[model samples]
Target: METLLPKLDSVFSTDCVIFGFQANELKILLIDRNEEPYKGWRALPGYIVGQDESIDDAAERILYELTGLRGLHMEQFHTFGDVDRHPQGRVITVAYYALIRIDGQQELKPVTNFARAAYWHPVKDLGKLPFDHQKIFETGFRKIRRRLSYQPIAFELLPEKFTLTQLQTLYEAILNRKLDKRNFRKKMLSYGFLKELDEKQKGVSYRAAKLYRFDRRKYNKIFQNDLSVEG
Candidate 1:
């Protein structure tokens, strides 16, 4: 009998497009690459997957290793397998994206030498990225833009207690358009899942705004009824 092994040409990697909202701006996390094919260029945090690791586990490891953040709401959006996508050989990549709240407390320090540093770049200020990452990011961004219409993911990117204006700002940033204030408030309130809080925002130079919190219990109860009706 003879030993069998995988081909040297077959390689797989995972790339992440981590998105965050800060100062009313949509941003994506990029790392300064330390190794070649595209050394010194900024790119999505990514690397070759371990042979024994599952794709999901590999994504979690890669994201944490490059960004030092964990427990994110990561979702696999697409896979890039173009023959020339990688300069080294036949490398295929699985791409994932996550939306996180920028609380100003999280530190981003790459754990591996492959990346020198990690930073966030505003979505609108981005230029051409190294490798096929530009296309990978575009695909993930479009997926999130479309997913926003059907999912309540925007709530995940807001503070625990936020004003209606803050909520609207987040939605407008993701959708990339102005939403009518009156209609937006009406539709959001109609859901009956936002609990109006007694406190107002502090530290503002001008008039303070009342705060509201997302009531998960109310949302679950309301949507359960809708699902039951549809079922």
Candidate 2:
């Protein structure tokens, strides 16, 4: 007896929520769509996955195709499959998120025809995004906020040498609230992973603040000790 195979009718795609911190603002990368369904509208850098590629490979490829950005680490967070999420047909999108230090000199340009341009938009008052992307952004934002509590992910969004005020500002931007300065500073210093440099912020209108860098080696040792104790 022969068995019939089900038809492959559904399509799969990937979207990226890349976050960066600059000038005391938390921003996400967005692209201006050139194709139909939501033409001329800003949306997450996304595209359909190829039939011959894995989801992870597709995510990286599509992101580069749409925004000309590559090599930054990204992690899958959620899958959106609302049936009507896409205007054409049944499309399931896997969303990936990454935090990176923004380079003011680097220009964003789309290599594909699907997107007209790519730029960073402040996460606050983002207004509305097309194709259920608003909800997707909200979910990714919450995931990062939760991860910030346990992980040193916020450090990824800061420069190599940053002021303590800049670090606290990044935290408040992600947490969406102001933190007590003295308490926040004391708690962060207690971690013993921030290496205070003999330098100060330059070219600032306000008084210069002391610069600090994340000490990865110390952090790793501390993490290893905690694991050993748990074991």
Candidate 3:
């Protein structure tokens, strides 16, 4: 006897919530959709996965194709599967997120006609996004905020050398609240991973502040030891 296979009615896709810190603001990458179902509206960089491709591969390929951003070590954070999420079909989207430093030197160029342009928008007041993306963004944002307490993820969003004030500002942006500078600085320095550099902020009208770099080696040693002991 032969068994019948179920007909597939749903589709899989991936959306990227790339957060960047620049000019003391926390921003997420968004693209201007050029296709219907909300053409010309800003939305997260996303696209449907190919039939033969793995979800991870599809995530990276779609992101680069739609936004020209590649090689980012993004992690799968959440999945959105609301029945009416997509107007075209039953599209369930897996969301990936990454924190990165925003460099003014690099320009966002969309390689695909699906998107007209790609750019960053402040996360705080990001207006309505199409295709249930606003909910997806909020979910990703909450995940990162929870991870920030135990992970050194914030360093990934900072420049090679950054002032302590800049670091504090980034924390405030993510947490969406002002932190007491005195206490924040003292606590961050206590971690012993921020190496104070013999450098200062340049080209600023205000008084320059000391620069610091995240000492990855030291952080690895400290956390690895803890994990080893626990294991």
Candidate 4:
């Protein structure tokens, strides 16, 4: 006897929730769709995964094509496979998230036909996004919030050399609450992964805060261990 399965129309897609900390706020990269189903609507940077391409490779290609950004570390976070997620067909999307420092040198001119433009929107102010993207962003945000307690991923969103206050601001932006300044500083410094540099913040009207860098060498040695903190 031979068994047959129904014809499958399923396909894969990659959605990226690229987070960045700028102006002391947490923002996610979004694209304005140029084509329908939801033309002109804001959406996460995403595209269908090619049949001949690996999902990771597709993610990189899609991100670069849609946002004109490259070399940022994107990590797979979740998979959204709801039957009604996509309008045209069965698109089971694998969601990836990345934390990048928003530098003035990096321009956000999208080079894709699917998007009219690419821009960063504050995570708190992102009004109803298209195609379950709001849900995707919410999930990614939660993952980062939970991961922050144990991982040093926050460093990715800060400048190469940042002040302790800047670091706290990034954390508060992600956590969406005020953290104990003294406790936050003490806990972070106790980790021994922050390298204090002789440099200080410049061009600010107030007193210049001393700068610190995340020591990757010490981070590597302590990667297995984690410093937990509360907001």
Candidate 5:
């Protein structure tokens, strides 16, 4: 192994931008950097990969160390290898973005010396961020919006049991367009993935709508291979 090794001039790292939906707005988790170059600036939590760790392993390890989260259904969407992406040296970073439902998780308290705090910032009103993160964030947000149109991704962003109105609101927020409720509900219902609960939404002033949950078993059974709609 030593004889087959060639000297390397760069290190690999993974930076994850975790997006969570709450209060009907898109949010991204950022860590306050405590290191130099961009110290005290907010950035996506990331760390250098271990010498023997795989890229996937490094990503999950970085996520857990920063957010106290694991198994986030993460996906590596892009690889950012700009020569100056890192001021430290030649560092190639694999950028990953994920959407983890915040419905049942504990408050994130990132555990790392480089990061002083971890918090969720609304995607709409973020100011300046460290590195090329603003570009990375924009890329991820665009992908999410495009994915929401053809896929039932609202189930991932919403609570366990939500009203159709709430689901439609999520789509509106993502697509930035209002959808006809009758048409939306009709198409959604035709899918047969929503399981109507015997319960109604509580704590609302107006006439409460019934709650429904996404049936994964039925969903997989319905669209097992390709995602398409038939008229």
Candidate 6:
């Protein structure tokens, strides 16, 4: 009789809770798992670690393998290691998050065999998820909310060419607060980071508003100090 291999006590994995904002709504990326334990349920994209690569590299690899996305500018938010988080074995999963414009929804494909299908689910009403995915998503969502306040990260969620309303909506969505139109525009323009272009918003019934681009160089100069972009 052939001898069986011994089991390892620990396993490491990386999970991504990707966020996409469109049409005044936020959605998360979920995959239909084809593996055991949760064969048909929706869950965050994740996979086991590699013996040769570090956790960071593994995260990028797993994300690309499952989502068919590359160069996401990924960020590691937290490390979840609970004894009962996984059903089959002891797994320590590091969760990450990404921001995509979703302008190219067709680009998303399931590259791995484990994921039978990949789709975006609205945040307003999410169904039951596998493992502690719900908790991981809650943590990632809160992290992005805090990051959006200081870092110039909202640009990732916006379109290449956008109007002021679209920009402000991104902020309001993250901050969950209403902002004064005049005050907000005045303050935002005063910073000089937004360059007013000759472009105007089209397809609107009302007076068309001018379009602008966020200036990276000017942004660094104005708020070089520990300034905050609250919400």
| Global lDDT scores for all candidate models | 0.85, 0.88, 0.88, 0.90, 0.81, 0.81
Question: How close to the true structure is residue 180 of candidate 4, measured as C-alpha lDDT?
Answer: 95
**Could you say which candidate leads in lDDT?**
4
Candidate 5 regions with alpha-carbon error over 4 angstroms: 1-6, 224-231
Candidate 5 vs candidate 6: which has greater TM-score? 5
Clashing pairs in 1: none
Per-candidate TM equals 0.89, 0.93, 0.93, 0.93, 0.88, 0.86
Name the lDDT of candidate 4: 0.90
Model 3, 1-231: lDDT tens per residue? 999999966689999999998788899999999999899999999999999999999999999998888888999998899888888778999999988888742578999999999998898879999989989999999998887877778888899999998888988898888888888888888777899998999999999999999999999877532211010
Clashing pairs in 2: none
* Residues 20-135 of candidate 5: C-alpha lDDT, one tens digit per residue: 78887767888888888798998888888988999999999898887777777788888888888888788888888887777687667777777788888887778998788887
Model 3: lowest-lDDT 10 consecutive positions: 222-231
The residue-level lDDT of candidate 2 at 180 comes to 85
lDDT, model 4, position 134: 87
Give the Å shift of residue 107 in candidate 6.
0.9
lDDT string for model 4 (6-86, tens) is: 987669999999999888888999999999899999999999999899999999999989988987789999999998998
Candidate 6, residue 113: CA error in Å?
1.7
lDDT of 2 at 30: 96
The lDDT-based order of candidates, best leading, equals: 4, 2, 3, 1, 6, 5
Global Cα lDDT for candidate 3: 0.88
Model 6, span 6-73: residue lDDT tens: 98566899999898888866778888888988998889999899888898899888877777777776
Give lDDT: candidate 4, residue 221: 89
